[model samples]
Target chain A: MKHVILGNGPTGVVAAETIRKMRPHDAIAVVGDEHERPYSRMAIPYLLEGKIAESGTLLRHDRNHWIDNRIELVEARASSIDADAKSVTLSNGEVLPYDRLLLATGSRPVRPPIPGMHLPEVVSCWTLQDARAILDRLRPGAKVLQMGAGFIGCIIMEAIANAVGKTGGSLTVVEMGDRMVPRMMTPKASALIRSWSEKSGVEVLTSTRVTAIEANVPHAGLLSLVYKAKNTKERVQVTFGDGSTRLFDFVICATGVAPAIDYLRGSGVEIGKLGGIVVDDHMRTTAPDVFAAGDCTESVDFSTGELMVNAIQPNAADQALVAGANMAGGAARTRGGLRMNVLETFGLISTSYGQWWGAEGGDHVEVVDEAAHSYIRLEFQDDRIIGATVVGRTHHIGALRGLIQTGAKLGADWKARLQADPNKFMDAYLATALSLA
Target chain B: MMNSLHIDASKCTGCLQCEMACSYENHGVFATSKSRIKVFDFHSTGRKVPYTCTQCAEAWCMHACPVGAIHEDKALGAKVVNETTCVGCKVCTIACPFGTINYVADTGKVQKCDLCAGKPACAEACPTGAITFVDASWTGLDRMRAWAEKLDTNAPTA
Candidate 1:
């Protein structure tokens, strides 16, 4: 058997290892678009914070780990795939044929349509190269501006804030959404995060959009001229929708990320509504002998029981395992993942489990302590905890996930108890889930 | 190498495979609640810290135990809880500053990382090499090597 895994990330690497484990003699090729060893993007912030070296970001510290496993680490951009031909064409003009193909080609940071967005100073904190660029540009007290406050944005924001604080630099975060993490978190939870950021000496601007970014170099009258000075290390200016411009040492554009599937444009594999490769529970795409996982694949949202992309590392591993097993001629099914997000912005911790936003007509219970920066909102579909959003609370996060994932129905009394004190999740779990077990 | 679990919290993914492995090794079933190791997810920043008892040389739990339930195993360098003697007073849980010691309600005894009697299951089960059983004396080897490598930056670029 031959397997060609795209993206060489957590998903692709895990799939390759599993394939090798299942079928030892199988030919495995793990292709990645990066120049360095396969590393985790999740560790980028740690690298930025000077906590871990670049090698620490690597998937495995041992250089021979891949070669020893007989997994070919091919560094090349995947140009396109001929599903009918069962071959993937690389940008380097190499056509690799595979008996089974896994499209783990994860997401690329979404570059907004703002002018002068492609300048060298304006970078997305998504890749290893991006982290290196950021580190190089960042010094103590260096003026840093991050554009976006989503999950990825907040992480980068925290890392940059830490880096800047050490250097006595200023940090500013601009989010176009009405609140931080608008898509994942509720308004109150997002507001709590913004307040937390502000408290941590971060200048957070929400409900604002950047219109254009330009260089303060000579002959840069318009955005195009500023973009023309893209290579210059000149001070950059960001123009807002309100027609006000602000200058920063460097800008990080963490606007968003989308499935990096432009090469799958004409591929027979079905694309989901969110531009992710749609895959079944077995992680198999529409095309036979072809599978998908990680940020690129749209798997089932265990909470909503609908097709959606939960692009977290754990989900990626789960999808990869299932996809690898089935590709290796073993029977396996992905139990799928809930929409779970746990973020630590600066020192404030927040978590959103399952369908954090309440379903229509769903009963919800909330407890807010604005002064202490603590908040909890539990959405119940009748007696079951369908979702929950918690801020500044970390101890019972596992229990919240347990209840949501298990679909544990709180008894009327327990539900009332929870409504009265949302912090009693551990007790609720002990009574409900443990009892049922 | 002195037997000690060198935890690099940065590499944790909150998979809880460690917790399951720990529970399975100790309790004969896969249960995180029964596991000695706990992975705490600090949600706001997306940091998953897998915390376990860092067996102190003069362990706090051992010192705080009323009935001398927490005993130090010299061979393994672990603070093994004598479950038979533990009355679950929950004193050791508070005495331990790291919060690694916990009182199990069912067992009515304190539980903590016993190093699996020298072969910690959590280290073996951690997918990301975040947790590793290493030489207790030189857990800083990796960090030192990192800085040492940086010092020779002008040497060459590969």
Candidate 2:
């Protein structure tokens, strides 16, 4: 039996492992659109700016996951699917049939229709190819303009600033938000980020919208940008945001991405409201014998149990394992993947697990350490640990992650313990890790 | 025989072992961002090259500093940063073409590779031997010797 899995992203990687463990005799093949081997796309900005080597982003750890699982990877895009025939047509016109099929088509970069956006310098993150192309032109003193305030946007902009600053490269970050991390951080938290970002010589312009993307293509000069603030809509020579016009050598669109479900469009696979394949708790699609996971599918959020598009890497991997197990004739169910994101930005590490909004509508606890330029906040309701955000000192994020994973209660003195010392919080994390609490 | 740290960018893996070791040796923290020596990753070519102050004897950074914060360490034959007198003006940072000297916001002072007073910690920590604390005057001696050995005068013309 040929086990054909669509998309070789994180989900497909884990699914292969589960399938190999259960059905060793069955032949496994992974189809992917990416030319390069599976690499950490999140780490590309760091790779581009010369913080981390590109090879490191290729994921050198646990080297034998694909080969050991006897998974044959086909590096080509899937054009379309023949659901009735249990076959998939490749971009190169090859059709491969499958005994068990898993659609992990993943996602692609979202390019908004804006003027001068079609230029070569206007880049986006869908692969390392774009990073490599941008890195080739990135030099000391080269100016950059970013067009989003999301996680990928923040990380890439930070990396660019760090890299360009390594050789005295100047930068400007434009965000159409009230705060740096509007969705993730509170106003107080945003102030802390704003302060830290300013100290690092990063010009973060928030609550401002980019109206146009100008180009100086042949001259290789900086790009001229126009923007107006959301509240005031005032036009000022603010090189940061509300400026007459600014110069930037290049522009990166970190806006967001959409699920790649073109293959399964006419295959009777139902897409959710978010344009991802609709799936239940078990990762089973509307069609029997067909399953989907990762950014390509609408997964149940373990935190809210709501059907959402959980495109984060961890959720994708967990769902793949569950999908593969059931496909390989094992009694395993996805049970939904958790919508969690753990990130280290500008020396400040933040982790979010479960519901960010609680009964009191995100009334949270915060510990601010001005001396250390650090802050930690935990959003919760009742006894359940919903969400957490931390900025500055991050010596013990792994331990904190364990406590969130266990869904452990903070006990009576949780607030005092957290504010007094991070060591106490670390102790709580260790206790959770040890399963003693 | 004044000595300096020689960097061979070709061999760098960009693992940042040098940065961590340098930061820990000088600042007592495993902070890469704070390190004087930086590894520049060229993602397109898949290259990681460690960069740092070359410690020139007639250091432009020394001459360019209005406050005379940079001076030659007679014993080590290396330019040492006098943090006490240094005003953190970043003039040296601007004057230096290589952009090695940088201002540390935490300490309100400019920091750069000081050759660990004589012995280099970056060279010691470099896993691939990309960096080495060799005699400054004869930095390329080892490469010369390797090439000299390969010149097979004894071998017949192939």
Which structure among the candidates has the greatest TM-score?
1
- The residue-level lDDT of candidate 1 at A160 comes to 83
Candidate 2 lDDT over residue span A1-437, tens digit each: 88888887657766776688678899999887777776656556557656556664553234575677688989898888777888888999999998778998888888766566776667786588888877865666666677776777766666677756745466677777788766656566667767776777888878887776655423222432222122111111223335457657677777778898877777898988988999875667887678887889887765676788756765665567667777887655555554455444565544444554444553556777765667777665554356666665433333344354446566555544554554455444423323222
**Model 1 chain B worst lDDT window (10 residues):** B149-158
| Cα distance off (Å), candidate 1, residue A316 | 1.2
DockQ (Cα-based) for each candidate: 0.03, 0.01
Best by lDDT: 1
Worst-scoring 10-residue span by lDDT in model 2 chain B: B149-158
Per-residue C-alpha lDDT of model 1 across residues A32-90, encoded as one tens digit per residue:
98998887776676678676577766665567888899999999999999999999999
**TM-score of chain B in each prediction:** 0.83, 0.82
Which whole-number lDDT from 0 to 100 does residue A262 have in model 1? 93
Query: Each model's TM-score?
Result: 0.73, 0.66
Top-scoring candidate (DockQ): 1
Instruction: At residue A288, give the lDDT of candidate 1.
Output: 88
